[model samples]
Target: MPVYLSRTANFLLTEEQLKGLLKRYDINGDGRLSKKELQVAFRGLGLNFSGFRARRALQHADADNDGFITDEEMKELITYAAKWGFTVN
Candidate 1:
């Protein structure tokens, strides 16, 4: 499914653009997202995920199990979010 409500907007983003947008949540610009960063990212998108739910998100998206979401891993997250009706802002 397309990631945004406007089908045309979905066509506007390349995977690289989408990936770069996810990195905006990396407050430290560390090239990865921590649990806390993930929390803010979710909050920014109006998602109420936190606590155990946030941890679960990290686990699902942290493909390397490194406790952080890399740029590549962010794709998994974006796909999952799109499936759940969430879109990157």
Candidate 2:
């Protein structure tokens, strides 16, 4: 049988959580982090997300041609800030 936990059991994320996650991954601190940066973070955190796949995943999300990604774009690509090695709340 499948048991559903209470709402409290589910992790909820706040803006600060998102910001912290971004800051953690933002190695160069250029106000943004690129897919390569995320790849490094994922590797350090023991997560699985290929660099090529990650780039492909972030196709339209990369709003600026500068190559680095912004927080808003990451959120949009992941659909939520918590899934891509980021903490929620």
Candidate 3:
């Protein structure tokens, strides 16, 4: 299970914690997040429209337009996700 998905529902996730949790979804072990991986991450965060959220995240954070969120882009992605104030239990 994704780390965030396993967290307690009342637990408020910090940006740093969200960052680490998101990183664990890099299924290809490429150290980067693809849109699909991001979708799953958003779903793990208990989002209803994960697909839309993932696309928005890419748009907001994929600086190179390469269709993947690399390490450098991760900060921006985290910042974006942080705005939602995700709470996982």
lDDT by candidate, in order shown = 0.68, 0.55, 0.78
Better-scoring candidate (TM-score), 1 or 2: 1
Residues 1-89 of candidate 2 have per-residue lDDT tens digits of 12111222444455545445555877777767778876775465455655754565456567765566776666554443244544433
Clashes of each: 0, 1, 4
The candidate with the higher lDDT, 2 or 3, is 3
Regarding TM-score, does 1 or 3 come out ahead? 3
Clashing pairs in 1: none
Candidate 3 lDDT at 58 equals 98
Sorted on lDDT, best first, the list reads 3, 1, 2
TM-scores of the candidates are 0.71, 0.56, 0.78
Candidate 2 shows a clash count of 1
- Point out the worst 10-residue segment of candidate 3 by lDDT: 1-10
2-77 per-residue lDDT for model 1 (tens digits)? 2452322324455566566667989998898899887877666555655554587787888889899887787787
Error of 1 at 72 (Å): 2.0
